[model samples]
Target chain A: MKLKGYRRPDGRIGIRNHVLVLPCSLCASETARFTASLVDGAVYIPNQGGCAMVKKDLEITLEVLSGLAANPNVYGTVIIGNNCEGVQASLLAEKIREKTNKPLETVVIREAGGTIKAVELASRYAAQMSREAGMLEKEAFDISELILGTECGGSDPTSGLAANPVLGKVSDKLVELGATVILSETSELVGTEEVLAPRCKDEATKEKLLRIIRENEAHFERAGESLRFGNPSPGNKEGGLTTLEEKSLGCIHKAGESTIMDVYGYGEMIHSKGLVVMDTPGQDIASIAAMVAGGAQLVIFTTGRGTPTGNGIVPVIKITGNAETAQLMADNIDFDASSAITEGRDMEELAEGLFELAVQTVNGQKTKAESLGFNDMSLARECNFC
Target chain B: MYGCVKLHEKDTVATAILPITSGEEVHYRFGGQELTVKACTDVPVYHKLALVDLKKGDVVTKYGQKIGYALQDIPKGAHVHTHNLYSTMPKEASTQEE
Candidate 1:
């Protein structure tokens, strides 16, 4: 299927055209936010990393920061940084340039003499970029040009039985149409490794998937904790999930029954098509951010208890299977899969409806989260900052 | 519409689509046949109900996969949750009982 989208200079298709005002470190976040607020079509993320970070942490922060700027949705970027931060504004801009040839401007807080001067300088740059972004014409692109990310949170029994399976059908159909789909949240895939490993396209891919699961589990062990304790979170238990295995079983269904083509580290760029897995923590917003950084233009999030999580750059389509939650949280939820259980709705039919909605969303249909301006962003940290 | 739904034929439990009171008739389609069972206990909406008599230590199956094990003898149609079911996976350090 074809959808109208903004074609980037780097040959990627984006559903939204945004000029981003991004901060390279915490010290410059307020300036970036103020700049974005001054421009009509600019978005900003208040990044908490960029200074005094360990090697591993610094690498992750830089990847996500640059990736967000390079995302197809962003028309250009105005990077703000604290002059003495470990991650410099000029270097960060250079890193982003390697990913996209979009317009870029940088402002160092200290060099600009203070927050007010930095904000004023950056805001002017952002305003000009926003006007440029607005002038770009939308072009038609096929579904193959899309990268869809799947995530689940606030899960309940209905999530597995209906919402997730419906997502699975949608995921399968997307892959069948030659589009890329990412299945993330490694912690949720713990007990279902056996169900997923065999779907890997090769021995190396299969081993990689297994190793990530092992490492995730080991991470918890090293902290004197158990994966089962935190998973099936209180809300999940109240919603009828009893164990991590049960949660994982339901969680993997969102991957659909497609062959696993590749596995990626958190925030890593997705180079291959078909269904891929990203090793991400089960935290909802963090996982979505990682996928969006990896270049996903849209995210289909399934929630049983309900959430209004949306990214600054990507549209998050919230799906729910609990009829009550769907009605009560109607303003937050986008699609209701609860009918699958309430009315015994055909899974295929529901999936077709979902696919059509996803197409419409890409064509500029505002999701509830988007309409409410729920631009939540978070980065996964491997260790404490130095 | 059925009051409870069975996700798979091999599942030993079904989830309540709505709150089911004691002795309430819950119907589900199994193997292409619609069957009825009397609720032996109050089954809250989205909660699980035993599809058959479950003995203590018996594996509780849902979605045709092992979810947990029955902690006590559970009659058919009885509610199944943390009180009567325990996860096979190790418990969290904080929530572990002495």
Candidate 2:
């Protein structure tokens, strides 16, 4: 299907055209927000990890910041930071520049003597970029130019039976079209990594798949928690999932039967084609944010209970299989797959309907969450021990 | 089914498994027993159901494994939730008795 999408110089497709003001570190977050507020068309995300993070976490943070700048929806970026931080604004800006030569600017709060000076300087850059971003007209892009990110939140039994299976169908269809599909949330795939490995097209890919999952699980073990038992949060328990294994079984279904292409580290750019996995935390907001940071233009989210999560630059399509939830939270749910289970509706049909809706969303249809301004994206940072 | 909550054969309790309304009817087979329930109360999406009678401190199994224990005697078909049940597992256990 052909839909109007923004074509980035880096060959990425974007559903929205936005100018982003990014904070380099937590210390400069307020300044970035203030800068964005001064501009009518600019958006900024305030985060806690700009400095003091370990090497791996810092690299991930830098990658996320730079990838957001390279995101097709972002017309330009004005990176704001403290000069003393581990990741300097200039370095991050340079990295982003390497990815996309889009309008780039940077400001240092410490060098400018305070938040006020930094805000004034950053706002001037953001406003100019926003005006430039407004000048681009929408152009048609094919489905092959899209990268679909799949995720689920507020899972229940209907998750595996309906919502997730529907997503699996959608994922497989998208892969058949030669489009990229990202399936992350490694914690959610705990017991099912073995199931995922055989689907890899190569032995190397299979090893990477297992390695990615093991690394994430080991990280949790170091914290004295089994990711398997730790997830299915209190809310998930209240919603009926008993063990991590059961949850994993339901969660992995979202990937469908696509061959695994490659595995990416958190916040790392995915240049490979077809279905890939990212080593990501199971936290919905964090995982989705990481996918966006890695350059996913649109996100397809499935939920059994319901969630109001979204992204600033990318549009998130919210879907649910709980008929009552679809009715109760009509204002939140976008597509209804509950009928697949209750009415014995075909999953393929529901998936086709969802795919159509997702294409519509890419063509500028507002999702329930996006309409509600639920742009809750968070950068993932590996915890540190003091 | 969307809201057809079921318990494994070895489980002592079942869950709504999916979101259900106050008057919704859900059918499932558990412990070789085919049962149907008309929800008496508006149950939140994933709340548990008492599969069989259980006295205080009886193990509560879900997905065929122990998730927790009944803190008080829970009658058949009673809603099992945080108020009446607590995880007896090593991690995430509740200390207070109901």
Candidate 3:
């Protein structure tokens, strides 16, 4: 399948033409927000992790910022930052430029004389970038050029039977088409790691996969806690799930039956093109943020509990396996795979329908989240390190 | 009536649908074999229920994932929650239960 996409100068594909106003540090987030607000076509991601975070946290921030800037959805970017923050604005702009030679600019608050000056300079750059972005035309791109990020939230029984499996079908089809599919949320992969590890393409990859899972487990041990007890949230309980292991089992279905080609940390760039697993928390916003940071142009989020979260640089396609949820939260959910469970619809048919919708979205059709202007995003920060 | 959610093919436990009362009979299925479980406690909804006898430290599965291990021996039909069930490996405190 082919859809119209913006071809970046760096040989990447973008489905959205956005002028991004990125904050280099947490301190500059508000200023970037105001600057983005000044332009009709600009978007900004807000978070509190760019400063005072430890090296790993800062590294993740830098990667997420760079990835967002490199994301195809962004046509041009104007990075705004405080001069003395941990991840410098100039450094971020350099990294972004390294990935994509698209139009780029930077403004430091101290150098610009403060928030007002920074906003003025950023708005000027953003407006100019927006105009240039508007002049570019969309061209036909093969489905193989797409990287699909699969996620789920507010899950219930039908998620595994309906939305997740259908997504898995789509994942299989996409991989067959030579596209990339990212199945994220390592915490959700607990009970099923043994099954998932064997599906890796090779022993080394499988070993690496197991190692990461064990590392996550060990990390939890150090904290004197466990991922299981914290899982199957209140919503999951109400939806009839009883344990974390149960949630993990159902969550693994989102990856389909394909072999995991590689695993990546949160906000890391995805180098391999086939199915990959990104270690991320299960929170909708944080998980989606990491996926976007990892360079997903589009995300397919399955929600049984239903949420209205979207990303600044990527379009989040919301699907649900619950028919009642589709009805109760019709405005938030885009595709209704609940038919797979409620109406006994075949997974193949539902998968095809979802695939078509994904193609349409790639071709510039707005998702419900996008249409609602829901640009909810946040960086996952562990703690401050001196 | 607590519904059992199977975690994996090899798992011997299914997650609880709701808090199960001690000695209440609940019907569940596994590997195409249906069985009746007598709840052993007010098993919180979204916890676990032993489909078979579990030894101390036996890994507990739900959604076919190792959510935790039994802190002590758990009998068939026993309720698994914060008390009897612990994470397979200690890790981060639970963050998704919100």
Candidate 4:
């Protein structure tokens, strides 16, 4: 299927044309946020890790920051950093430049004199980039040019029974259409390696997928905890989810029935098309952030208990399968997929409508999350060994 | 419309889509067969209704797999939440127990 999107100079397709004001570390975050506030059409994200992070965490932080800027959804970027931070603004711009030829500018908080002066300098560039971004025209692009991210949060039994399965159908359809669809949440997928690994396209991909899930289990074991004994948050329990296996079985539904193409590390760029897996924490915002940084232009978040989380720089479509949560949190929920279980609606018909809504979203239709201006985000870290 | 929905034929429980009152008859369809069970108590919307008489320590199945074990003997069509069912599995999805 064809969808209308903005074609970046690097040939990537973006469903939204946003000028990003990125903060490389926490020190420059307020400056970046203020700068973004000074300009319309320019968005900023909070950064909590520009300095004093452990080596591995710093690397992840840098990758996530640069990747968010290089995401196809961003038309251009204005990077800001505290000069003392390890993630320098110029260095970050360079990283982004290596990924895309989009317009880029950098400002160092200290060198720009202070936060106020930095905000002024950064906003000037952001305003210019926003104006330039507005001048771009939407072009029709093939579905293969899209990277769709899938996630499930605040899950209950309805999520596993209906909502996720519905998203899985759409993921399968999108994969069949030759588009990229990501199945994330490695922590949640711990006990399902047998079920998921066999779907991998090749043995190498299977091995990679196995390693990530095993490593996650090992990580928890090291922390003297058990993922198997302590999952399905209280909200999930209240919503009828009884075990981690039950939750994982339902969470994987969003990947649909597509074969796994490959596996990627946290926030790494997803190059393989069709169905792929990403190594990310089960934390809602962190998982969404990893995929968005890895190039997912749009996100479909299925929540059974209900959540109003909107990932920064990506349009998140909030879907729920609980009839009461749908009506109770009507303003936050974009779609009520409860009929799948409530009335036993035809699965294909339900999925077709969701896919069409995705198409409309790709064409610039505002999701309830976007309309609410929610910008939830978080970066994953290996440890606090700094 | 059925008061509850069963996803798998083997599931020992069915999820209630609407609030079910005590002593109400809960009807659901499983593999083209309609079945009925009298609610033993009030079941909240989105909660599980016991599809079978479950004894304490009996593994309750949903989506055709063990979701949890009965904390106490649960009569057919009783509200099944944390009150009478709890997970005793070796692994879980959340970070820690609350």
Which one is best on DockQ?
1
Q: Tens digits of per-residue lDDT for model 1 on A222-330?
A: 7776665567678777777666667787888887878999999888878888999998888888898889889999999999999988888999999999899999999
Estimate, for each residue in A21-101, the C-alpha lDDT of model 4 and write its tens digit.
899888888888899999999889988777887888878888888899889999999999889888877778877877778
Better candidate number, 3 or 4, judged by DockQ: 4
Q: Which lDDT value does model 1 have at A322? A: 87
Recovered fraction of real interface contacts per model: 0.50, 0.13, 0.24, 0.43
Which has the higher DockQ value, candidate number 2 or candidate number 3? 3
Which parts of model 1 are misplaced by more than 4 Å? A228-244, A384-386, B8-13, B18-25, B29-98
Model 3 lDDT tens row, A72-138? 8899889898999999987887777777788889899999999999999999999999888889999
- DockQ scores of all models, one per candidate: 0.38, 0.10, 0.16, 0.29
For each candidate, what TM-score against the reference?
0.86, 0.78, 0.79, 0.84
Kindly indicate the candidate among 2 and 4 with the higher lDDT: 4
RMSD of each: 3.9, 7.8, 6.3, 4.8
Query: On lDDT, who's better, 1 or 3?
Result: 1
Is 2 or 4 the stronger prediction by DockQ?
A: 4
Fnat measured on candidate 4 = 0.43
True lDDT of residue A308, candidate 1: 82
**Tens digits of per-residue lDDT for model 3 on B38-67?**
777556654567888899988776544566
Which pairs clash in model 2? A25-A50, A239-B46
